[model samples]
Target: MSIINQMLKDIDKRDKPQFGANRPKSVYLGRPLRTRRLRLILWGGVFALLAFLALSWLHERLSAPASDARPSAEQLQIQRVPVLISEPTQDAASQRADAETADASTRAEGEPEETRPRTTRGEQATVVVTDLEPTQTRAEQPVEPVEVAVSEQVQVPAQTSMPVVTPADTTVTASDDPGEMSIQRSGNGVGSADRLFQRGMDALSAGHNRNAVQRFREALLVNPDHIGSIEQLAAIQFSRGFAGEALQLLRDALERNPGASDLLLLKARIYERIDEPRAALDLLRGRQFRLPQDADLLILQGAAATELEEYTLAIASYRQLVSWRSDQGNWWLALGFSLERSGDPLNMQEAAEAYRRALQDRSLSESARNFALDRREALGY
Candidate 1:
């Protein structure tokens, strides 16, 4: 058997014809074949992966909108309103520079030209704002429409320090809040009261509030009953954290013009500022002062009634508001809120109905519509 195996090995070595002595056949030949096959497989897989990635990136790029798409002019205007700045002319700038240089030279020389005017009045007492809320809404139940009082031509105050009357093409429409009044005047050929009021308004717009207050006062002195002066001055006082002063001023104006709805409403707003909603409501109380037809009065009544938990009155007032402006989704929402807070079982279905109606209004803002929808769903509508 050993002789036969030796003969078989000798025959296999002769037939295979070995290339190198002492070299392993498997290490040289088998390893190289296996490595070549593995390399081909790896390269194929890499190419396939790259192709897949390229296809995915191309698909994404094709699906998106073009990058160069632009908004319309109107859309751009709405999205980004431009702020205008006052530009002084070259002459004005030169004059200002010259004045500043003269001032600097005077200070450098230490020569007493003139003492700066100092205010004689001492520091005014600062009034702390009370946490009390005012009850009044803007219910100004006027006995009759208060006509604008016209005077025969009042003299314009001759103050050189007054701001030059620039021809501004701007027209500011006053806020239409219930307690507020609008003041409109032409930039050119306006009445003395109007011109002074305009100057005060300009000063206010410029944020020179002290100057604005002075101009308003001057306007009032020129025409004591100028509604514009009264409204603007009170507004400024209120803004300057002097709610009490504004209220008192409005009260004085009301005394002079008892039937002025604007004054009554303004006073009510001040009452609300001091956390006295009941007082605000009282201002509009009684059949003589019941201004059911007045939209502004109804709005104030609704707000004050709601604050006092007078749900029935609130509902009635809100309903009147809705009738006057059916397109106003907020009024409907207000009515719905009043109904829901009434705590009466009958009011539940009515509240749901109101919410549903509000939801149907296409003009309603997204947030308001969502709020109404949520309320309707919660009420099992």
Candidate 2:
């Protein structure tokens, strides 16, 4: 078996050529070579693109039109509104300059500058605004109205600085508030009086009652018909515990300006302040003092009448007041208060209704709401 294997080995070696020598493998590249040629090709592509772009830009610039800049006439325009002469010239500035030069020469010669305008051969006269003329404005100047308020506390009335000549019939109107009075003005010596009145108001607003009274009196002295001064002075007097003086001042004003609602309101307020409800009622009811239905007056009447135990009058006044301004919670409460006191049994139902309405008012004070609730429960409504 060994001899046969040796023989087979010899035959295999003889059949195949000897394996000692080697032939170089056909030259082969390993991985693809990274060469500078590739870099050169990339750089050439970029340079060609840049050259094409530069050529395109130069061509566009050369082909574009040249813009010619002509001078604009707008450069010579002075303003939208021109000052025209009686005979307008093409050169307005030159014409104005010549006029100014002529005026200077006339002044130098001490000649009265011609008052009349120099007329042209064919042109009509033009009214041009000169430096001496006032600025153009509306011809009529409306007087600032004096507004008086005495609802919660005494507020100083508005005053103006204008000197207006009082018309024979100066109209009086109610201002925006029912508590306010606006007097249309036409007056004389308006300067002194208006200034003094304004100063007095400032002083009063600053809590200087004495100084306010003094200023208000001075205003009255300057113009006795100064209603603001009179009213403010009277209010100060009354607030300072001078009831008689306040009443006397109002009385004198009422004598001059009869049926003045503002004056009447102030006077009635003073009377009420002094606890003279009957006097206040009389003043309000007087034929001479009758005024258009006023909320302040009506409320004053209700309060005064209620204090006097005149429930019927109070109920009437409160009803009217509520009718005019139902949202006023205090007015509703006043209506209920007066109704409860009214002797008529039929009024109880209405009184309870008023109480319920008072409770419905959000503006009603906490104390007032509680009172309304208790009264409503007690009345079984």
Candidate 3:
């Protein structure tokens, strides 16, 4: 009991209400200050964590380059990289080199490389081509150059050769070649008669009537009965307007040879030349009796009739001549002209037929055929 009493007494003293309330208030104030300090420490630790995370993000963004950070599709493409290894054996390398050289030589042979002018950034490359051969340049290039010759050609005079004449062996005296008879004999043997006749004929041909007549007379004196000389002389006299003299000589000649158609033609020519066409016609008609089928004589008669303006009779004569010598275009032309002048349609038809025949003749000249054709057209045949 005593121990219990003592403990109670101690407890009662310690367990007082006011003492208890005071002790609790002091403890609360001290605990409140410590609690606030702990809260501030916790908040500071959270802010430090957030600041460290932000600084780490800023460092990561500033450290990376823009191009390395974002790669494009082209940059993403994978490339095959070659790794250099050891070279091949010597024999294999030599064979490969030979094949490459052969290929290069073959390409060079097929298509030769052409040289072209090259230019750099600021300068141009100059190229010059020179011909290999001198003669080749002459053949390939088109250039005209003045030519110089080492020597010039010189002309020499030609040498001429002439014939040499010698003196004749024969010498004749005047008595040896005598008068007209001797002159005629000598002229005949040496063609002197032919030469004299040719001179006279030439004078007549040149229309020198007086000279022709004189030459013919001289020839006749050398030989009195020279027929050609006499006829020529008569023709010259007739041409000189001496028809009477021509007729006298022609008549005398005709008496010697009545059948001479040439003398008759000559006499008719003389008669016509004197404007006596009727007498010429009579003479031509008388000769026709002697020479019936003479085409030339008939042509002469046609010409004489034409001169007399007897166109019908002239056409008849020309027709007769054409019938005898069908190849003669002049006869046809004459007949056509005369018939056209006659104004007889029947005669005109006959004349056209004659010209047609002449045109068909191959032996006629082109001019003659054309003339006959022109006459036929003029006659309206």
Candidate 4:
């Protein structure tokens, strides 16, 4: 029995169980139909869901109004508004054309009608009656007949009264004689000398200086020793920058007419222009002494002193000028400039004070005030 069991066990082991080894066999079966069916169903479900979403979107788009689909309220409102159609009016164009025609007619009346604008159609313009008024024929107005009245002739007595008349003296001189000298002068009936002088003045006014000089010389020849001509010639010479010639001429004239303040002042001006401030100062000082109340001479003297860098003397002269004409702002300005240049602190302060005084004067020009202010700023005051 043990032997039989061992053989059976060997057979069972061979047929049923191997400890660690097995024979090769097919592991796979054919694909299941239900798996394919499940795959097809899943794919169909995905496609159906996609088709359903697309159809839903199409239905939403088609079902909504076009205006509601837009996001903008203004665009929706614009779409909702109705458009208006306008018809053109011919009356406006006709009125414009009529106004243009009337304006052209007025302009044509202003100019010659032959020179007026022509129509391209080559049609002659006809006069159109704009107003209807009553017209009367000349024969329709009746002519009135004239009437005459005759009266009986009557004679009246005439009386003659004898006039008291003075007897005509044969020796009496006739006052209405044409040869009688009439000493009466009329308006501006200039003599030959005055006319020549006026012509020279006109030439001077017309800027013909050389012609003016010639005319003035002729006037002097007509009336030699004419002071006006001499003085004017000297002035013109000085204005032309011939100071030496002017000085000599004026000096000669001054010899004839001494104590002429105007000539003295003119000489002083020429001297100042020539850079001879000392001489100018001397002349102005002399004039000031002669005429103590001459503010012009005092101002001139101050200017000369200022030109010479004699600030103290300038201040003194300007002070005198200010005393003479207290109302003159230019004098105060001159005094300020002089004092400012003096280099003395006290005088500089005095100059600033003088400028302030000048600013208070109503006659001071804006340029003058600005200049004074500029000077004050420059002095660091």
Top TM-score model: 2
Those runs of model 2 whose alpha carbons end farther than 4 Å from true positions after fitting are: 1-187, 206-211, 286-293
**lDDT per residue, candidate 3, 1-381, as tens digits?**
999999998888888865876675655668878999999999999999999999999988888776466444333322111111111222344334434544554464455223322222232222222332343234444322111111112222223242333222212223311210111124332244445677888987897767777777777665555678878878777766777888888888778777766677778767766678798888876444323446666777888889778887787787677666777766777777787788766676777887787777777788887888788788676
The per-prediction CA RMSD against the true structure, in angstroms, equals: 30.1, 23.5, 43.8, 34.8
List, residue by residue over 27-122, the lDDT tens digit for candidate 2.
Answer: 434323545667788999999999999999998787664432332332221111122222111134443444554455446445333542322223
Distance (Å) between predicted and true CA of 359, model 4? 1.9
For residue 102, give model 3's deviation from the true position in Å.
Answer: 99
Off by more than 4 A, model 3: 1-225, 239-241, 289-294, 309-312, 337-349, 358-381
Worst 10 residues of 3 by lDDT: 176-185
What's the lDDT for residue 75 in model 1?
28
User: Which stretches of candidate 4 lie above 4 Å from their native place?
Assistant: 1-178, 182-196, 207-211, 218-225, 239-241, 289-293, 343-349, 362-381
Is 2 or 3 the stronger prediction by TM-score? 2
- Tens digits of per-residue lDDT for model 1, 231-269: 889988888889888988988898898777777777787
Error of 4 at 381 (Å): 7.8
Ranking by TM-score: 2, 1, 4, 3
Q: How close is candidate 4 to the true structure, as a TM-score?
A: 0.42
Q: Which one wins by lDDT: 1 or 4? A: 1
Per-residue error at 22 for model 4, in Å? 99
